[model samples]
Target: MQKTKLKALTKILGQTALIALITFVMSEITLRIYNKINPSFVFYDSSYNRFRGKPNAPDYDFKLNSQGFKDVEFTVEKPAETYRILGIGDSFTYGVVPYQYNYLTVLEEKLNKSGQKTEVINMGIPGMGPRDYLSILVNEGLKLNPDRVVLSFYIGNDFLDNYMTANLRTEEKSYMIALIKSMIKIQSNYKGKVLNPTTVQYNDNLPTFTDEKYLEDTINKSNMFVRNPADGMFKGFVDDAVKDLIKIKQICDSQNIPLTIVIIPDEVQVNSQLQKQVKQAFDPNNQNLLDFEISNRLLTEQLQQANIDYLDLLPDFKATAQKTPLYKPNDTHWNIAGNRLAAELITQHLTAKNQP
Candidate 1:
């Protein structure tokens, strides 16, 4: 009787194991098919030391080219009479909007309409910083033989991103974790959240210009240099970023490519109401609200000292904000109007430079 019962138990355990194996295989197959159909995937790039979008990903209306850039396809060899401009930076340059709506694309359209043969390649990668930009330029940007390079330096959290690059670790996700996260994302969408559920929801009752708690939180989230924890490490990050910029300039100079740095300011910097709120929140006594501009001034000064050409967009953005909203209502990134203005400004600057 004991031997018979032991045999039955063994049979039960074998059935369980087989079922699990079959389930895992089915899940793996389904995931691969889903990924192929909806390629919203980002994978770790060992060479660049960061995560990059998958090549040829059909993510929404935007499609990444074979080179993992969020732009149309192009060969390594430049076409005759076609001037290529490589736009490099973080998400602002990469853009979250449709491909044709991005600033680089708009700039290209305006340039071509003005009778100049131009192709602006969007080399922007989301969540990258100065170090990643340098790595990308060395490893990929130069290989395309661009005639000019524009670095869109977004002053929002670049210093913080640069500082954090020192501690960046390789992304590792287990199959089980991925499955769970995917399910959670689906459930979040079902509950009316957007496709990407990483957005922050602010309190409804908070005043725009006077709520201390909300303003403080916004400052901490929006301006990395002004955050309390960044006090001791701010200068170090700025120095590191400056060194990387110099390296980028050196690379561009060697290839005889004109490198232009375009300074993109944060929404708070241009929004008067937000600025007032931040000052009240952080400096009730009106002590030092200008501390956030320190990083911008430092970078500008460094560019001047290095004799590098840079266009500060703060004044223009501020001026434009008086008449229109350049940024999204709640998000940090620029809206369609903002991209249009940026493209217009960049076109004017470049057109002037190319004049006889």
Candidate 2:
């Protein structure tokens, strides 16, 4: 009886192992097959009607690196010391729209048309925030030794993205995980095919909260997961950003190169209804994400303390949105007309600064 029972147990174990092996093989085959098929075209959903037909690039060219970033390729031709500007930021700095519609390209065209010998290199990448921008500036932007650096700070999601990804790349294990995450995102093209549409509703008649006390109270009430960088969890984020801006200033000062920051205003800040909706999501009492505001405000103060030149494009960007469909109703990025306006504004600033 004992011998028979032992044999039966061995048979059951063998069967379980066989099933597991078969499952693993099937899953691997399915994944490989899914990878082989070219996915459908991905489109950016617009939140509003005005951004309809705004130009955008249909494909991604650069692959994500192990660092969770794409190796941005730039040409080595040096402009004849008249003006060579390297524009750095997230997707906005990146020509999100088609090549011609990219604001950097527009800025280049407009500047050239104005008979100013200027070379503007677009060093923008998507899904990046201030920390990533600063990292790229330290790691990549410094190589070219540009005459001037134009950094765009997208006010909507940058602060959060910066905070979230900061720690992921700081430690060795976490850095590897982030690299894998970026590689996984390369599969977004495949995943986006079956994506469902999502809509955000805003009551346009909502009133704006203009008081700081209300803002702080609202933020404290709404934000249950506030990880204060001062408390150490977000130290990587705080260090990367604060230090990077300092480095940017130090490098520019040492080389006599100029640095200009373009504060890209969030669409919600312009549309009162959008602001209220966002406030409701973030901090109903504060209305604005004071953390984001504090970070940018501190960055500006740091720039001032370091004597680095800067430009606030919020007013101009807001005005352009009011005039044209600069951003899609659902999307926070600039449309073609908005890109043109941004390019015009950036070029104008650069031109004004370079005036002898």
Candidate 3:
């Protein structure tokens, strides 16, 4: 009786293993074919110590160029009448919306419409900061021989992002894993877009965003207001950001190229009501703990000292934020309106610069 029972158990186990194997293979095959049709996932690049979009992949439906950047294929030689501006930064510069809706694209159209031929090559990548910017500038930006450079600096969590770039980890190369990650990221992004799902968190030690949309990513993006326990660093993050920019300045200076900065403010800074909510969350007794201008003012001072030209969008954004929804409902990025506003403002700035 015992031998018969053992034989039956062994058969059951073998059948279960076979079923799991078949399911995995089928799923893998399906994913492979699906990816071929619509390839849009980022892969870890050991050489650059960053995640680059797959060549020719339509990442976020914004088709990447041959070089993996979300811009048109650029020639090393500049056209005689065409002026090229190389735009670089983190996600803000990468843009969440489609390529057509991106501010850089709008800026280019505006420039060209105004009778000056221009091309804005976007070198933005999501989850990147100062360290990554430096590497990209050295490796790729200079090679294109751009006439000008425009850097987008987001005040929200760029300082934190800058400091955290030190902690880089190698992601496992797995198709299934990459697919799941892409799905989760896209789903989370859509959930808050045009909707306010990312409510403020009260925990002082925890990251500001407690919503499921940003929970997985919150640990890394600590803004000026919140002091994430894991990092045990915030103020220094500001200094480190400026430090990196100074280095970028030195490089541009050596080449005799001009660099301009566009300061992108955090949503909390623009949304007055959100300010109250975050204040209450952190410390109701001291509602003024979160100062919106702290990050901007600090960075502004450094840029001025370095003689760097900048266009701070915070004032204009705050002025019209209540009148219109400049940012996505709960997300940190600029909505369509905000992007348009940025393009218009940049148009005024650039046109004025070329006036003389």
Candidate 4:
């Protein structure tokens, strides 16, 4: 009886092992197939501070050059008679739109069309902040021998991100686990409501607002920066960010590379209707509202003190937004129109500076 029972147990164990092996093999195959079909995934680089888009991704028809940047291959030794500008920033610089439609590409085209040989290498990575920008410039950007370095400073969350850098890390997960999680919708994209005036409901007579909750949250967090600069948390972030920018300037100055800091305003800043909505939502009882430009003014003051060449896009974006939508209705990043306008402005500035 004992021997018979032992043999039965062995048979059951063998069958279970075989089933597990088959399941693992099937999962591996499915994951490979899924990755091939959908390549718009971002992977964590242990070396970099944030996630990087998958190299040679097919989903967005995106291709990462050898250095993992979403740009064409470039040599450390820049070619003669060719001017290269390294654009570094967060997603606004990386651009959600197609590579061809990106502002950097448009800037390059506009410059080249005007008989200036230029190459704008996009070193922008999504979710990066001033700290990462400084690091990338010091560690990698200087090696490329760029003539100019353009830093696109998105004011939405860069200060917050720079202050809260301790929590940034890429999780370690196996391919099978990643595939399973993705299949089950465990990974989700951020869905911030667009504050563009044209897309939201507006009543000329009645006070109307959309995404009051988001607006409230934004106000609660960011209002301190404008209203109370002496707040410890806000002061800390500003100090660190200024230090990072100063470091960036020092590096560029040492290398004899012209650094241009482009200040990108928040969505609400450019949309007057949205600005009104924000005021209504955040302070319904009061007629006076804090100027949203306070944040930009603070940064501008620092740049001026440091003698950093900077351009604020709020005025230009505000003017252009009056005629057409510059940002997507559902997303925070710029649309094609915004990208084109930015390119035009940057082209005009650079060309003017380049002129004898």
Best candidate, lDDT: 1
- Candidate 2 at residue 163, lDDT? 54
Estimate, for each residue in 280-328, the C-alpha lDDT of model 4 and write its tens digit.
7667776365577777888888899999988899889988888888875
C-alpha TM-score for every candidate: 0.74, 0.62, 0.74, 0.74
* Candidate 1 accuracy as TM-score: 0.74
Off by over 4 Å in 2: 1-74, 79-82, 169-240, 281-296
**lDDT for 312 (candidate 4):** 90
Q: What is the lDDT of residue 231 in candidate 4?
A: 50
lDDT of each: 0.74, 0.56, 0.73, 0.73
lDDT tens digits by residue: candidate 3, 1-356: 99999999999999999999888778767766775564433433333334455557664445588876778788888878888888998878877666777899899999889877888898887777777777789998998887788899888767877544455343334556666776676565543232112242211122223355443332224246553335745657778988888898899998887888899988777888777666666678975555667778878988999888889999999998989978764557787788899989988887888820
Q: Candidate 3 has which clashing residue pairs, if any?
A: none
lDDT of 1 by residue, 183-285 (tens): 6655643332222222434222222332444455566854443644435566676677889889999999999999999999988888988877777766688
Q: Count the backbone clashes (under 3 Å) in each candidate.
A: 0, 6, 0, 0
The TM-score of candidate 4 is 0.74
What is candidate 2's local distance difference test score?
0.56
